[model samples]
Target: MVTFLLGFTLSVLQPVTGLRGFDTPNDAGGNITLTWESPDSGKVMVEIFRSQSPLEGYQKVESVLSSRREFVDTSAIDGIKYYYYVVSIGEDGKTDRSEILGPVSSAPQWFNTKRWNVLIILILLIIIFFIFIRLAKKGTKTYIRKIPGLEALDDAVGRSTEMGKPILYVPGLWGLTNVTVLASLSILRRVAKKTADYGARILIPNAEPLVMTATQEVVKEAYLEAGRPDLYNERDIFFVTADQFGYAAGCDGIIVRERPGAIFLLGVFAAESLILAETGNSIGAIQIAGTTSTLQLPFFVASCDYTLIGEEMLAAASYLSKEPVMLGSLKGEDFAKIIVSLLIIVGTVLATLGFTRIIELLSTG
Candidate 1:
């Protein structure tokens, strides 16, 4: 009877079994997965613990129902060895522990299998880009729609030239790192070329010293390319105060004093968008504005003669230059958008018809 009672007590104490752990797969890797077999006797809550060494420093990581049988320790440090075990608590307040298992370390994978869809789409874009570029290089005709803001550039420069007044160009209040500033620089090159050809003086005021320096180089290069290097003046492309409203005020002063015939406001703008645009408007200067700032777009639209909205400003470099590589890349991205849109629509229809495999594939990827 004693031996039988000892056997029964041991069975009751053993509430969990077969505890094991391994590093998670297909991940950047700072995670370890643990699994255990719950006892068939009844429900129990399992608490997971981890340690750097097998016999010490064990810290409780998580508590889960025995039925779950699995847990992922996301806090596990990559490249470090770890030991883990589980303690199961029964309804009768009895507790039992599973054997420790580990010395396993997490490692990052080179490629994630889950992102296969992204890889395929990336490959597709590259193929499309190359194909379009090849066609363009072979002199095949490709159509790009008219952008009125860009088209009016030459007329604005000519008006300044005919009126015998200087043209003012604001390359945005942002630093050279801003993408809108880069786009503005591309448009600046075009304007510089036009001004050089027309012999109309161009004045560029910058809020960033780096942008001022870059503008000088860009304008000088444009002048050189136009074979009018003599017309390039470094002094005209200068830095104003870094303060937002102060820069706007300085630009306004230039408009009031220099009385430029035309103003080109292209790049990122904030509250100062209206301040500058309205100032130019008061001076009766023909203004063309473009920015990615949605809040300030209305101000530019209301004050400027032409406003290049959002992506139109981004696409201006390719549109104005017509370089085969740039145009090809632009068109390839457009094709990618169309493809993604079509897939979304098709997936929606399939899901509605109870064919969920397509939706599942997309969702998983």
Candidate 2:
């Protein structure tokens, strides 16, 4: 009876109670906050444990002073339910555990409110794009500034015709996946049609086989569209080497032998740009060059008779084709740029005046 009474007294000396855990608020998930009230008995430390389920294995996560009542468990996985309990150790080395507070599962939010500014800006741009497209379809005119390189196409082809020499067009060394190459092809259609109308030969030496096939198709279509299908020659549009300098050397050989009166270099180019440009210059060819490669722009500007810089290369298609949809899209892009500029200026001024609401509103994060 005395032994049983002594065990009962020891159990009463150390006890743990009042444990609770819940999902963290205002979070992207994978977090839980736990809280418990310490027992009336004096304690030294409290240890936290987690388990997938209350009836299964439990792993120690953290240990805190007994005076602390709360802990945040950030290691929990999203969409997983977890159970947590705490063990309190007393000054006398006695230990007790609280009841497992459980079944809390972290969940991720579908949308992040932090990027609201990005969503708003994207929606605005989309609205602008569609608005201009609709306006253009209604026969509304969109004004585009004259691009000199694009405007001189007719004269360039005319010069080739008068000289009775082939017109050389290079679509650069890049593949069909490049936007610059696609733009070059669009311009080629126009150039091919002009050449067909004048009955002048047009030579296109490609660095990629796929681009050569595409160029041939585009040239043939242009000839057909010009009502001169009889003059279209598939042999004139052919593939050269894919090697950068090899293609440049082949083009230089053509410039030396065939001596094309007019050369059009339009697409993505690299170090070989100057090689071809300088060779065409030495051969007295009237070279009109356009590329998105900024590194090669200075060489083209120095060697070619006319150069289309940056956006002008992209604008050449819409300018030459005069398609309302493309023109409208270009106009819309300019309008959006103006809007962004204005917003930046306004935001800057407001920020300097200690009004940060506008700046904060535009921040993506």
Candidate of highest TM-score: 1
Q: How many backbone clashes does candidate 2 have?
A: 0
What are the per-residue Cα lDDT tens digits for candidate 2 across 1-365?
99998866664634456677887765798889897777655678888999997987999999988778789899999888898888878777877877888888887676677887888888999899889988998998777889889888889999989999999999999999999999999999999999999999999999999999999999999999999999999998888899999999998888899999999999999999999999999989899999998899999999999999998988778889888889888888988999999999999999999998987798876
Off-target runs (Cα >4 Å) in candidate 2 are 1-51, 57-110
- Lowest summed lDDT window (length 10), candidate 2: 8-17
lDDT of candidate 1 at residue 213, scale 0 to 100: 93
What residue runs in model 1 are displaced by over 4 Å at the alpha carbon? 1-13, 40-44, 52-59, 65-67, 91-93
The Cα RMSD of model 1 versus the native structure comes to 3.2
lDDT of each: 0.90, 0.89
Tell me the lDDT of model 2 at 304. 99
lDDT of 1 by residue, 114-198 (tens): 8787788789888988998888888778788899999999999999899999999998889988999999999999999999999
* RMSD to the hidden true structure, all candidates: 3.2, 6.4
